[model samples]
Target: MTYKAVFFDIDGTLVNEEKEIPQDTIEAIAQLKESGIDVFIATGRAPYYFQHYAKPLGIDSFVSFNGSYVVYKGKVVHEHPIPEKTLELLESTALANNHPIVMQGAEAGYANYPTTRSIRSLPNRSMICVLRCPATEAATGRRRRCTKRCCIAKLTRNRCTRRPKLRSVT
Candidate 1:
């Protein structure tokens, strides 16, 4: 297929379970840029999370917060915020379940509570915030992963390069 632009998913497709982006992948992106192809990352992560990332890859644009937000050349091209009514409903649901709720928007990621209660109660249990589950499990009847680690490993393996770049220093 002939294409003028290429889009990549970030979490599993680019960065692995350890959240490491591969040097080869970065080099590959650089090469693509050198060839005059447009490269972009599509992710559930907020645009700010990509601040330290996109520059090195020569990414021309981004679709963040699961496409609810878009950025080009450090400027917002589009933004879709969750309505307050929806937020209220979700919060109420979560409160009933004694669980935590997280909201991921174009600008940032936020949790109702940063503690483990919120972390443990999430159905899909993604690090990135996306309103995919009901506030309470009873309300949604969602089936969560029986095993988190193995599932995470499988998920990361499927999305990222086998050998990704690793750095020790923060």
Candidate 2:
């Protein structure tokens, strides 16, 4: 009858339209945690983008990349990456259509496009790296492929804020 944990989505649930967490929300989370209720973030955002908000809010559990990955108390609890074949197809499709692709890994984010201001605006500014290779290279290990447990493909344009069609690789 009672919930033991609460999961919050980052974009609109935890943070407001301006991407800022309200004081009341912070206090509410604190109160819940103080009451021994586990608070977690369930979002499509990559893990690299969690610390800024998670740390401040004292949330240590996460279901990131739209459930493709999960972490509890700094340890990986679950992860699922897109199949290699699917990744290849997606890469080729994006290239053919000229749709920018942003790959989210357990540790960092990768993009086939050149470094733009929008990519730099990600929560953890330093974690999202611009891939040096062309779109044809895709995720070749020779060029620092995302070696994380889970990788999600995000289809978008130059501006990341634009409605990116999120696709889970797994």
> Which one is best on TM-score?
2
What are the clashing pairs of model 1? 12-159, 94-135
lDDT of 1 by residue, 33-74 (tens): 778777888877665566556766767598876777777766
- In candidate 1, which residue ranges exceed 4 Å CA deviation? 16-18, 48-50, 92-99, 116-170
lDDT of model 2 at residue 37?
91
Question: Tens digits of per-residue lDDT for model 2 on 52-160?
Answer: 8888887889998888788887787887777667776776676568677776666555555636685567765543333332222454435443322222332234312
**Overall lDDT per candidate, in order of appearance:** 0.54, 0.65
lDDT of 2: 0.65
Scored by Cα lDDT, where does model 1 land?
A: 0.54
Query: What lDDT score is found at residue 12 in candidate 2?
Result: 77
Model 2 residue pairs with clashes:
82-169
Task: Give the distance in Å from residue 55's predicted Cα in candidate 2 to where it truly belongs.
Answer: 0.9
